[model samples]
Target: MTVTATLAGLDPTTLGDALRVAGSPGFDRWQDQIRRTGGCSDPIHLTGTTVTRDRDTGQVLHSYSTEAEPGGRLRVACGNRRASRCPSCAWTYAGDTYHLIRAGLTGDPAKGTPHTVRNHPRVFATLTAPSFGPVHNRPGRGHRPCRCGIHHPADAPELGTALDPAAYDYAGAVLWNNHAGHLWRYVTIYLPRELAKCAGITQRELRERLRISYGKVAEYQKRGAIHFHAVIRLDGPDGPDTAPPAWATRDLLTNALRTAAARAEVALPAVGDQPARVLRWGTQLDVQAIGAFGHGEDLTEQAVASYVAKYATKAAEATGTVDRRIGELSELDKLPDLPDHTRRLIRACRDLDALYPDRKLWQWAHMLGFRGHFSTKSRRYSTTLGALRQVRADYRAAQQRAALGLPDPDDHPEATTLTLAHWAYAGHGHTPGESWLAATIARDIQHNRDTAREHRAALDTAGEW
Candidate 1:
């Protein structure tokens, strides 16, 4: 129990290294940060090379190498797939996502506005998955009839369930999810034609008069259905299109969407006894104007931006599924306590893996049967995660310089200064004491978010900025 007793048989250099990493001033804050990070839980620690050029001459004057950090270990914040994984990093990601989406809609990088975007008609839309076979679901008010003619209990386990499991169309639901992106693309493409027709304009000429701009995200409903929520905007040529037709109302956009969803369907390759598959949006597609005045369930630019950003960090595992990068097929049957539906999804992805051997679905076997990008957007929609990461990198680098008392804008390209670094993944995760700290750090972040939400709620109530 005594210090000497614990160190009695330890190697001197190894013990000294331990003491330094654990107790040195340089590592105290870092250790605290690591403890806060909870082993980064899902940190994306990266090691890479940066090549910078002279602003005027465009000559490659400087290259900062991290190839030598311990084990070549470079302690970059792990970009997480879930907020639950790392709040500090996720929060930063979420904030960056917000601004990225916001800038696309509002067009102001600093204040997240285009000044002209507000003049456009924008709506937040949510389209949910069709019933696979109802599991439990949130209660509804003033409920509609269940075509089955039986009133299901508000908390009843029968909601969203297909009356017959054998005929429940699970294949369609899964495939719908798999091809949902394609269906969405079809809609995006079709909308222009429909809008043009409705507006008495040619498809090619549609852009001359108006444009459709949107940002959307997919979410899972409890019964294993993938639904989408979107922010749809009607803009002009330069985005948030300047000239609006008298017909460019929220009602018009909603009408165009409804019509498209009804008719939009894509034929995917067939499987099992199932006939050729035709993928489509769920039977229930809700498009409402986003506003507080009950104008249209106003998906305000800010609210929609934030809402979509929140879902950006989630992975399939959050829904009791896996991330799908399985080491082997045999591993699928051994995923501990996974639910049947999730297990089925994983198998499906494994099967689909044969179709796109390059994507390696079997490799990502934990992600169920789907192997597609989780969140993506059109280039014009906004900034990117990479861009956001760069901003933070620049900020942190500046801070590092400030700490060393380097000159402001340390833009020097001098390569006279030699560099040496080396690091290995000293094995991920924390000692018990560090785990304790990581939890504390996460709690602090959640608390801050809650407090900020409360402040915003108060502001909304008072109608003040």
Candidate 2:
């Protein structure tokens, strides 16, 4: 079979190389490696050797070397959760995020959460950054002309652009992003205080009666500002498994959130000639009560989980900014593809770096001055991403042991083993032929997963599980 003829629309040069790779003797092994990665677009290459030994008997149990593998190196997924960087990894990340958020709300025995958590008071809250300057926006409620004298569409490129870039508070915009994490921290601290006050009890008494659990993700707005979407829940002192006091209701949680948000403020010290600035959340606060399971509402458990997970893998790219670190000032000039608004934000970050070196504005200029993790959760909210990844690793190890006819790790009461490994980073990414093949495999795998999910949903609708 002529592989080149089968693959239409590919350039002749790329087709020839792909055909040669397809006919190579190591093609099967190479394909297996790519499949193992779920067809990651940019996999990391490593040169290494690993030896497993029985610690008690001082016997070599297993030995492996990348030199023996195809291309004389091992390839591993980069595991970046950014969708633009690697879709394969991003999909996995979104799935894990969905599971983590869902487990907290709906409970999952496998994840060590109780089903009774569904009874906890929960709300979906959105905290936004205060305006640094007026920008074009589509006002909700009755279509009206924007301040720019034009009714901008939801997808308009000019929607978030400043009406007057020169007069806009660019420094304040960047600084707000830098301090967003601190603001959120203060909000969390004040939340319990407000709840206690509402209950006419002290902080210590409130803690003894109830606890606050939350999972939040930061998202970039089109104007290059960061906002947060969080699922906030009220649990008993011991956590989700225990029922909250009768006084804790969704209305109480909403009132407490509003009070905390209004009271939470971060004061920034004067930088250079700039005066001390006080930053707080925008007035457009949204706090909605999440309905119980099977209830029809926008704030249902599944809808909230899906919404948070959808943004977990996104970043400044959604706001016309690059999703990478900016190293030098001159680098920005070389890229004409960036929008003017994004360029101005990046320039502001760079210009302020000298004045506020401690903030590391230049280092995170690509992110528009935000350096915090996109997704974060309070301890005891649910299982963690690290724990989920460890579970996957353990499952894979068990599969490998079974394939090799070895005893299960749990079967041996007093057995112990030591693993000796040394690895060096060789490089990253793939050759042109490899890149095409890996992308195809990734698409197919994602398609299959989607199909399976749809089929399961259909079965669930028909009461088939």
Candidate 3:
């Protein structure tokens, strides 16, 4: 009666009646969710029927009739969060990604890695895009002169600003960003080889005694360039959770990085079948020793972990991959600060999108036709995003069950089984109201993380106490 009354044309009088009957508990639950998290900018409202079967016997013994659920439909979250695309969902995803990256770095996969693997020499290394013709820069790494006489200011927005916009190689950068995954895949193969060469062992033999375990995140530079920041560690074949070989010092790892960055290269099909494009990492490569806290000037392990985690949730959209599709050359015009090279790459992505519609590239059309996962890791590189997420879910479920005071929570079976759900997108984004709630929640979350960082820092400084 209460639920039905609330649905009576959504009038204030009826709403008051429903609230009085249903009480404040249920209302608070709904309101809290509305304020804290959103599924997407505009979530896909769904209407559907679902049934779970006994995999063993293929028998359906229960069902939740739509008559029983909210308007015979469920309010499900749309899972996208790009403010430009799906702000609501993007927020959720970004946070999840940060946790995932942090979990790997801290060896706290899921419930957490109480294990000792957290202390490895895990450094966050960044590899950047090279000169695709002169761009306005601060003039030098050490303050050398550019071909132009102007010495760019330290805060100059023009740094990486193209001197000759017409001559800018946007195409090259776009293709490079697209192929970066492959380039990374190549790095996975070559960096180890470089390490092996340094150790005076064949790649295979080197593997028998030592292993390079790493987790990496890719980020987009303000200049529309893609750079990779990774947590690299050399462990005995067993990897983190185990001590590395004595030979696997940070110095040796750094040296191997230098050799690998210079030697790694791959070739992609040339534009318009003209020729082949040789691909490799950018000239700017950085490696730092990540070890015990405060031992060096490099990024700390925990800080690096948090950094990688931060980018885990970003999409090409964050760096501005709108439209996810391009109909013609003019579409590129709508984009700002995009180099001609990048524009050409966007055009190429559109072209390739047709060649492989199976890839659902148009869905990522804003990414300029690349469909590869933006961030990935080697199979053996600690816990995975999936595993970490599952653990968190399990923990959360346990907490909920505990709150309910349910006995043997994991084994509890729903006595009744029947559900019908239907929901249509009212649309996404904060309706000023929801937006205020989300922002407030986001601020709270940020503070909580800052607190955690400080706590961890205190613990590190106090060590073994």
Candidate 4:
């Protein structure tokens, strides 16, 4: 068959481009690059040269350049943590988050946490934003009608929409999202003081005797407000490596968290016509002890870790908003399908930005004015995301070194090697055909992961039996 005939069924625009790529000698190399990035949807293209040499003798240890790669550029994962932006990178990020949280709850010797942490007083606490106004909701078990007087279906588009849009406090809701991070900081400060009160000691004495460590992830409620789910732990003064003092009990930790959350508040000065406001956590505080293993009415360590990791890859997009920054109010007009409630919230951000320029509300209007990391942890909570990423990078580097027959860095402890590299961003993303292939690779990789996980789970179940 003729080449044109063979390509007839393919997408018209990408067919010629696909043919050109497939006919090229660098086709395999391009595919290899995509595979190396785990098929990132928007891989960054970089042009660079790197050289590793012995410091003293200046002996060349390794040399590499992107000039030999496909199109004389190297493609790397963008490492975006938002699943709406890049699922492959987000999946990797979620895995790292899971391990980081798990290590804190159950401990991991490799991550510098001792198993004794499982015995530490740990609680899974959820801090929610106060109600701006009543909204449509499914009172799941109670079978009660919404305040607006209707039973909404599970998939109703209006579920989270305001029952009375005109009366809803859009300004307050967005402002709360903007100051959510600040409110969390207040909680941290008050938490220690509350702990001191529970132990019948002064704040100064509490610092020397005990420490509070936690890993928290911010989640967007359907109503576009930010809420926090955290695994709060009480550790000895030295951290997870040491056991907490006798006075530090699980009940003590839970009570302290409840009191701290109640007392935590952020006072915002009046901006223009906007009135002064004090933001505090919602009254619906949920604090539950984390069990070492799954049991009746107790959250398991693994369950809590998985729950936090799941949200780590999400953002305000969960509230039916755009995943990227809203360039201007005009952009909102272009999205005809955007929920009216969400549109009003975006408008609130744009309007507030004029008075509160420092908050950069307009710049983050897409996020409903939230401008904080979705996931965060205290210093002694567990290993950091950076540490987890570095471990993966080091492992990959070691594998590459082994493949190239290079000596391990540990082998030449006294002989230091210096690396010099310069990289310039060329571009990003892929052509239509390349995107199709990359998506296929991503699906295959995910499938492999799922299969491996299921196999291990089956083995564990059998062992339990």
Error of 1 at 184 (Å): 0.8
State TM-scores per candidate: 0.74, 0.95, 0.71, 0.94
lDDT per prediction?
Answer: 0.62, 0.88, 0.59, 0.89
Residue 430's lDDT within candidate 3 is 36
Model 1 TM? 0.74
Best-first order by TM-score = 2, 4, 1, 3
Quote the positional error of residue 203 for candidate 3 in Å.
3.2
Tell me the TM-score of model 2: 0.95
Model 2 clash pairs are: none
Tens digit per residue, CA lDDT, model 1, 314-428: 6664457655356766775776776665666566666666665554645655544344566676655556778777877788767865765443444665522332334344345
> Local error of candidate 3 at 172, Å?
2.4
The alpha-carbon lDDT assigned to residue 371 of candidate 1 equals: 47
List the candidate 2 regions with Cα displacement exceeding 4 Å: 1-7, 11-13, 53-61, 412-418
Writing each residue's lDDT as its tens digit, candidate 3 over 1-465 gives: 114332455456544544453454444543444433432334333345555344445556433333343333334456653445555555556666666556555566433343465655555689876666676665446377656677666655555556786776655666666667777777777788988888898988887877777667777664556778877766667765566677777777888877777776767665454357786787778877665545774566557766765666565543344534566657667678655444554665566555444545445556654456656766656666666557667786567546644333247564333323344444333333333333444456557767997998799788842
Candidate 1 stretches greater than 4 Å from native: 1-27, 32-39, 44-74, 84-87, 104-113, 133-166, 241-243, 269-273, 292-299, 328-336, 350-365, 410-427, 431-433, 448-465
Q: In model 4, what is the error at residue 17, expressed in angstroms?
A: 3.2
By TM-score, how accurate is candidate 3?
0.71
Off by over 4 Å in 4: 1-11, 54-61, 294-297, 414-416
